[model samples]
Target: MLNLVLFGPPGAGKGTQSEKLINKYNLVHLSTGDLLRSQIAAGTELGLQAKSLMDKGILVPDEVVIGMIDTKLNENPSAAGFIFDGFPRTVRQAEALDTLLGQHNTGITVMVALVVDQEELTKRLLLRGQTSGRADDQNEELIRRRVQEYNEKTTPVASYYEQQGKYVAIDGIGEIDQIFGLICQKVEAAQSLES
Candidate 1:
């Protein structure tokens, strides 16, 4: 399996690129944010709890996110691969994911991080807020908090993958196609190495 971890802060174009990657690679999209939003939309107890934390720009507890991911992995036993977005936000979560994937006889192929400046992320998110109707994107303070949280808690995930020689960083400030092409090059290279 060609499992990939699409890493970035909010508004880093992971969603857009993930769609392209999924189409090209035939990978299952395991987006935790979407999963949580679905739960929230259904008004489940977990959704209510996640909504409360998400509104405050706080990450939902690791176990909740991990459980959701475990369920998805079980649901797709014969997937070509999976593109993981908005997940493994902390090193502990990364470790948990490694263990989870190991139990299934597969692991992350690579982690492609979209490197964008904080100022740009804020601008993109604010503009997205105008159309996305997502409350989290509408407030500047909340957006900053979310990015800061990612920096503090999630940046180390790069090191975790880097240690495994499976981390690649691409500039996220160019045309969408250009950035995606760069990602494809890196992904193809990783696939070759795996083969």
Candidate 2:
């Protein structure tokens, strides 16, 4: 198993890279955002709760999100591995994730963080907004807020993985393929070490 956490600020290209990684590695993609959307679509209690928070531009509670992850994990008993995106935003959530994986006798293999500057992220997100038509992306205020939120709440999670010798930072500039190649190298290196 080669469980991975794709870590980065908003517009850092986690989605794009995760798509390629999953295709190449046969890993299940567990994106918390997609999970929340599905729950809301199904009108589950947790989804309703998450919707209320998300509507206010706030994050859903960790336990609610974690429970969703639990469900996903249980649903895929035979997955080669999983690529986790946008779930563990704080140290507490990171701890919870480790415990959850521990219950399954596996743990995060690596946390591949895509490093991008604030200005570049803002530019990229706004450009994406033109095509994405996501209301949050259209507002520069919201974009900056999202980045700041990640800086304050999420960056420490990288350090948590770093302490465990499972953190790798990749520059998030230049061509998409180039960046993804770097990510692939990091993941393969980690896999080799584990083997």
**TM-scores, one per candidate:** 0.99, 0.95
CA lDDT, every model vs. true structure? 0.96, 0.91
Expressed as tens digits, the lDDT of each residue in 1-195 for candidate 2 is 999999998899989999999999999999998899888889988889888877666888899888889988999999999999987899999999999999988999999999999999999999999998877788898889888988999878988999999999999888999999999999999999888
Q: Tens-digit lDDT track for model 1 on 45-143?
A: 999999999998889999999899999999999999999998899999999999999998999999999999999999999999999899999999999
**How many clashes (backbone N, Cα, C below 3 Å) per candidate?**
0, 0
The residue pairs in collision within model 2 are: none
Model 2: number of backbone collisions = 0
Best by TM-score: 1
| Runs with alpha carbons beyond 4 Å of true place in candidate 1 | none
Worst 10 residues of 2 by lDDT: 50-59
Model 1, global lDDT: 0.96
Off by over 4 Å in 2: none
**Top candidate, metric lDDT:** 1
